[model samples]
Target: MFRNRDRSAETPAHETALACLEAGIAATLPERVVADRIALDEETIAVGGATYSLDTFDRLVVLGGGKAAGGLAAALADRLGSRLDDGCVVTTDVESGSVGPIEVREGDHPTPTERNVEATRTILDRAEAATAETLVLALVTGGASALLCAPAAGLALSDLQATTDALLASGASIDEINAVRKHCSAIKGGQLARAAAPAPVVTLAISDVVGDDPAVIGSGPTVPDGSTFGDALAVLDRYDLRETIPDPVVDRLERGVDGELEETPDAGARAVAAAADDWHSLANGRTAIDAARGVARERGYEPLVLSSRFAGEAGEVGRVHASVAAEIVAAGEPVEPPAVVLSGGEVTVTVDGDGTGGPNQEFALAAAIELAESGADAVLASVDTDGIDGPTDAAGAIVDRGTVPRDEVDPARRALAANDVYDDLDDRSALLRTGYTGTNVNDLRVLVVPAAD
Candidate 1:
């Protein structure tokens, strides 16, 4: 029997399999893979052969929120050393051993809370206090939208909360949800950067959004935003969220739309186009592919890297990949046997059934059902790099032909509901958990298509 209690098959390379899964995940996160790629030394922060003087600023303050922000800040503090002034960062993971002069606070993810609002206010205050001589190193990573929350002016907590809930439940994509959220918040949509004008803002981005749009990544807290109140209203309209919004939310958005308030900083605006601002990308989805390719070479398998920017509905994406992997496992057509198919990107869950799993979980679960129903010979794992997927603590899940047993699963029924895979993979002890990785690139998935016997 395998290490699993009810294991039907055992591979001598299970440890290697687990290592590949972990490495693939680590490769996606920027902070984990970027330190070596960029010159982050004690004296300066350098990228692309250009160096920024670290000691020129009178005070160095780090402020941001995300699943990876804590770890990334810690790495920066480690690199900055004595140059770093008092620093505070909020993240889902509370890592204690950060570089130095930095404070870590835990925040909720995938959903905002009263504490999230309060913590964000604190971060804003820190940003606002920065002077011309101060250098603000903004570490914006994945999960930031929920980790840091602040309602826009005249918007109450209840209003923001209600609007967010409705938008998420309405099958809206992240881009759409963020458009609404950026308008509804004070810190998002480049408002954070505008808040700390004259003070140099160097943004270190670990992009989880597709196409790597800075304005959409964590709603562009430290970068300039192009999203407007009109765009936000359009998102709400496109999703038919007008009638569903709370009265207070409708009123607040109406006020903004009527020019009663200023919109988030516009792109190409003079203030945002200044040389005082610096933006550098540490890593992204491609890093995961690189990591998987190296592992594939070591494991003696041909590695085929699909797209790193795969998106759309999570369950549907899983079905497509599962079908391809199944064909390779059974018939050995596309790439051959003993091959691994690797993909990395962020996927969305529309929240119809309000199931507990995230995009990765939904993908794994959907794939599991597909494998189980078809009796495929493939092994697979799907995991979020930050170790938390959706509302649940598990980053993601793993599966094979032994997922739910052949004659058992109601395949069409489960995938119809979003992320119901958590229910099935939970029984197999395949849920991957690593707490918080401190860095996030997005989701990483690997499939093992063993040779046909």
Candidate 2:
């Protein structure tokens, strides 16, 4: 939940927006999601539409890494109870702790680290130990690409870290970033499935990517990878990062492209093919967006879900949202007044300044300026569903027509130009801070336009 909800919700519209955001995020919590999507019967377990007999497997083990993996492992442990033999899950430091019988290990995110490597090795070890009689429950989610760090042969952790940092700063889409990641890592891109070969692996994922592509989510550790080493090289070229990123990454990718190294397992790969029917997406941006829409309707507002697949530059996306608000206020083109326009998807910000802020913060700042300039009587709030936007402590921010005073518009513009929206939003008391909300379905945005008087 937002820590400053009361302080930020100074108006009825603000209150409604905050409530929608809370509902949206709550709908994706691992505990809630797992409980809704997974069920245990007397002798069988059901996940989504698939059911497996518990007696079929002599051992059940969990192995995965991500921001939500710890929570997912805990919830699953409760459901499996004594049936679970042992498990290990690597997650972000904030979410790490012992969960029932599972060992929850801590790791970094947005960047890989030595801790991540060690924790991921433990996860891989568990996966590799599984036999034909074992049922491997893989709890992969957003952030697993970083949390489950395992450099490819001849690549060091530092090479991955540098590549990750460079790619993140390049304003690349999550799909593109993961394409590169799937090539550079040893455990990602169906390698985890290969490690647990002969044993049936069931992956329960919380999608944080656009299109809800399992192959891109968490770099598709349990699913077949559609990307190739050539694709990875193309990402670096597209981002102009080949020269800037570590040389070793370039070399490894080049080697793979030249057929000197094996490519990530594809759909035809045995391990991926065997478990093709078992990968389940527990929740996604649409799940949160729908929850937000329901809450908006309950709050006496007509809900208009824009899309759950919006992408591109964060500031540009925010401007588009502002234009929608302006249209609703002026001519009610998309919908009449008293509407809460909702959207959910990941957005990226290209960092050119030393200042700090995440995509949602940048979005809020841009939208705030547009709302003030256009004189739209509306409140807008955006937050990363995982509760951490960029490297900042604030989840995102909330703003409205009054967020920017007349004299400070230039300053606000400067702040955004410098990639310092976090400080500027904080100065205006617009930053929304919520630390690590248990799950990730990407970014959520709410725009509330009041009915005209």
Candidate 3:
């Protein structure tokens, strides 16, 4: 939807911006990052710090699920070729084949469906038979929680959907949501690693969670789980979401938390005890920094790559970025005018209102509000590499000085209140939309502060 009249070639600045966005998103996809981290030698695969020699293993197979699991599987097949044995991966963004010996099955997202549950079962069956002589390449990435759906015993898909919806609507942080997800799923909370016991499991991960906590990232399908049913119940209680949760599902988790039900295996569990697997972090915020730097340089602006581990409430984070921009413009403390500050990380929305936007959108809108109040001459854009944010279609939004109003801005406040940042910026043509970018590197934010006249 290029609405401008210019049909000429894209300028270096425009191209750089687009390229940065694309690269930032692609870098988070499991296949793109994992394949690069894993190398194939004469007879072995070296992933991260662990090496699995074909000479030592009878078979090498890929089995897992996530938004990018299929892509990762396809890439591994490309590298291993005929050497790669049978495997299946469940994901939301399925495309035409790029590799053999790996099957890509379509799955759901945001909430798990019956089809997702069934596909997850299929993957589990494949993992259960893994032997020590076999190499289990478990591809884990963002969205694994929804992609690899298998409800706990007695939990139903409808129940999961409702609970998931509440969590989304409740504005619970990703960590909190996934904590509950880990407890409710049969395969999460390191259960997948447990299922593949006796086998050497090499997990090539692309972290979407801040700090990349293996146990929390994608609900830690292959890592040892330290979260308990009590933790899950605590999230529900902390968010006051108990009423929204299904009774049977709550009862099941409550039982587990109360000790009537067995707890999920902890760090000392056999999966960790067996020493049968290794966790490999393949990619993270580095890509975003590189892309941002490239964009800023191309735009004739100084680029400063800050720590990408940004986290906290979306609005609060946006205000911090705005303050930095204002400081740059007024005093040049961090950098002179004509500078860009780029960062990457996941942010949270506390769900204070009925709004249609993700963390990125909320951040942009919030920053725009502050920029307007302070009369800051800057433009801010934040986006989720996965394309869909929360439940909205817009990737994110862009905010500039023109976006900020001089008078009391009740509209922006209302938008933020309702979590409807998209509507607030719709008139300005500020919403950034890229449907399903096939990757998820968490959140990317770019701030451009121009020089004063």
Candidate 4:
């Protein structure tokens, strides 16, 4: 639920956009997603389209980390009840809580910390303790790359922390950032599956990445890694971050490229082959997008789902969305007026300025400027499905034609250029704050264009 929904609901268009956002987020909550995808029939348990016989394993334990892992673990624990022998999961402090028999641990995100390393050590220990009779249920989801940290040999936790910070600020795609992270970590890229070898690992994932590649989600701790050390080094080169990042990180990758370090486990690797058939993606951006589309239809608006795999710079994407709105208002080209455009995907910010704001905030601010310039009577709302945009507590922002004051247009442009749209949006009462919504399916954006008068 949006905490500031009432305050932001300035018009009918604002309310419709907010409703669509709420529907999208609610559809992906762990309780709803888990209940919809997982079911128990006596000794047989079904997850997605795959069924597992609980009678086959002597013990069943849960292990993994992510922003949504805590909620997923709690939902799964309730479903499995006494069948779940023991479990442990690391998540953001906001999502940490009691989960029956599962122990919930807190860790930082976007940047890993000493606490993350310690919590990850516990997860790896649990994985290493698994035997042939143990069945591990891995709850790998968004933010897992940061929540489950393990420094590779010859590297310290500080090395990882510094490298992670640099890569995130580089505006690299999640896949690229995660590719580098997998190579630097000891528990990523199917390494956790290797640690829990001989025990069948069933990965239940909530995908936040584009295309929903299992190898990229949570850096693929429970699946084979398709990325190599060479690939990671290339990512740094592409961003020109090799010289600026931690020295040890570059050295480690260079060594791996030279065969000094072993690569992450691949598809042919024994660990991956053992549990390759058990990985399941229970929810993703499409799950949320579909729900939002249904809400749009019910509200008497023709819904146009652009894509659930959008990427690139956030501001540019916002401008494009605004352009579409302008066209619809001008000539009703796309689907006529009273249309809602819905899209879902993860967007990146290059972080050229010292000001604080996430991709969603940047998107909304950019769209506001474009909407004002085009004189389109519409409303746009964009938010991270997890209810936290970037490092800020505000989920995102909602903007209308009047959002940018006519006289302050120049100041608004300056704020956006400085990446300081958070305060600007706040001053306009356009920010949407909902705390942590206990789920993450990347970002959801809605553009509501009412009938032209």
Looking at candidate 2, the ten consecutive residues that score lowest on lDDT are: 92-101
What are the per-residue Cα lDDT tens digits for candidate 3 across 141-214? 78888888888888888888998888977767777888888888889888888888878777877778778888
**Candidate 2, 389: how far from true, in Å?**
0.4
Query: What's each prediction's TM-score?
Result: 0.91, 0.98, 0.92, 0.98
Q: Measured by TM-score, how close is model 4 to the native structure?
A: 0.98
> How does model 2 score by TM-score?
0.98
Local distance difference test, each candidate: 0.74, 0.90, 0.77, 0.90
Query: lDDT at 8 for candidate 1?
Result: 22
Writing each residue's lDDT as its tens digit, candidate 4 over 1-453 gives: 888578888788999999999999999989998888888755987877878899999998999999899989889888888888888899984545558778888889878998889888988999999999999999998999999999998889988888988988999999899899999999999999999998889999999999998989899998988899999999999999978888999999999999998999998998776666799988999999999999999999999998898898999999999999999998897878799999999888998889989999999999999988888999999999988999899999999879996778899889888989899999989999998888889999999999877
lDDT of 3 at 228: 81
**After TM-score superposition, what is the CA distance of residue 450 in candidate 1 from its true location, in Å?**
1.1
lDDT score for candidate 4 against the true structure: 0.90
Q: Per-residue lDDT for 225-273 in model 2, tens only?
A: 8899999999999978989989989998999899999898998998787
Candidate 1's residue-wise lDDT over 1-453, tens digit each?
Answer: 112322322463334445566776666554555576567666787875668787788888888888788777777777767878976677876733344887777777767878788878988888889888888878788889877799877777778778878887777877888888888888988777777777878787787877777877887887667776777788778888899887777776678889988777776655455422477667776776678778876888888886788888888998888898878866776788688788888877777774566788878777877888777778777777777776677778777777667666675356447446565566667677766666677888878777667
What clash count goes with each model?
Answer: 1, 0, 3, 0
Residue 214 CA displacement from its true place in model 3, Å: 0.7
Collision count of model 4: 0
